[model samples]
Target: MLTPTGEIVAEARRLGVGAGAFNVITVEHAEAVVSGAEAAGCAVILQISENAVRFHHGRLAPIAAAARAVAELSTVAVGLHLDHVESDELFDQAAANGFGSAMYDASKLEYADNVAATACAVARGHAAGLWVESELGEVGGKDGAHKPGVRTNPAEAAAFVQSTGVDALAVAVGSSHAMTNRDARLDHELIELLHDAVSVPLVLHGSSGVPDDELRAAVRGGLVKINIGTALNIAFTGAIRAAIAQDVTVVDPRKYLRTARHDMAETVTKALRVLTGATP
Candidate 1:
């Protein structure tokens, strides 16, 4: 069933669990994410990032349409979200194209400027009845420019959310984006502080850097939404490599693509289990 992002977040809040949001670059990715959610009997979010739109020549309609189709056809609840979108135009496009939620990222700008931009985006998204997410500080891995010690101030985070009226807040504690290793240590105390200070749900970006145990701990400490990308890509591509290596003469795209999709689905299922504290 197709679900709104706000509803998904509310469920996570009610259950005291973290909702997993997976980035989808292709139709296969969308299908795999939904399949994983169904396997876990949990709801999941399907996210399309600005980088993915750029990869598709700035066109969001096609991918958004495909994700919507997949979500509607799936048995488990699914929400479509636009992740880390910096441009107003693209954000508007995402809302128009049926994305139930969007993360307006203006973290590169000065503090006040980022707030103003994100506020405007929030208003626009609200007008379209879309759940809005925004980041306070840089969440690291922005082309390797993030400082290791940069963390979101709890007071500033509360102020930002009050000012922007965003539905969710992505805070920088210690995780960095695009991390290949899942060793980033999160500040459990800071997560609790932010959760207490902010009125909305707290989101953890660059969650791929945090290992499974740390992720469960983060959830227990107060994180609500977890955005994962690199780990799934690693699982997907690794399966493709293994498939090709296993059959040197195989040329059919479906043969290898099937394995890639299945592997990604398994990864998402495991992640959901961890985030929701389900027994494996």
Candidate 2:
């Protein structure tokens, strides 16, 4: 059923478990995420990125509404989250479009500017009764300004949350964004230190780059929210390729899409089991 992000995440914190926040770009992604969560008997967050909004020609309302409906109807608790939104207008759009929570990515800005902008977003999101998450420092492995060695400081992270009043904080703990391979090594020591220092929940971005064993360990080490994107993209693209190779004459969208969705669902389920330690 549809629930507040704070409620879902707070329960996770209490239970010593992390919630999977999968990025969604299509209807199939949404279906597979919900199905995976239900199958795992765990709550999940379905996220739509700023890039996704741009891909859909700026019409996020319909897409967000559909995701929200799926979350509302799911057997397990689910949250519709807007990810990496930089503008207040975008955050406003997401809040109005039925998103339960959102992350405003002001990491590209200067430290003070990022803090100010994120604070504004937090205020607006709280006013709308939506949970807000923000990134302090940068996660490496992406084309962004942050380099791989630039890790978030524990003291800085704690201060950022205290000043901004956000529900969660995404800190750089050694994982990079959009990594196709699972070779990134996380500083488990840093993760534990940050967890001890920060009162808010810790979010791990670019988790797709981390191996399955490391992911489970990160959660065990106190990371609360894991954001995965590239792995799902890999499953989706690989399934499409496999389906096309098997039937060269099949041109129907449903034929290949059905195969892709099934593959994606299995991938999600596998990730859920590893990260959340949930078993059927």
Q: What is the TM-score of each candidate against the true structure?
A: 0.98, 0.97
Error of 1 at 263 (Å): 0.3
lDDT of 1 by residue, 197-275 (tens): 9999999999888999899989998899999998889988999999999999999989999999999999999999999
Whole-model Cα lDDT per candidate?
A: 0.92, 0.87
lDDT of 2 by residue, 138-241 (tens): 88865656777788899988888999999999998889998999999899999999999999999999998899888988998999888988888898899889
Q: Which residue pairs in candidate 1 have backbone atoms (N, alpha carbon, C) closer than 3 angstroms, thus clashing?
A: none
Worst 10 residues of 2 by lDDT: 141-150
Backbone clashes in each candidate structure, one number apiece? 0, 0
**Candidate 2 at 236: error in angstroms?**
0.8
Maximum-TM-score candidate: 1
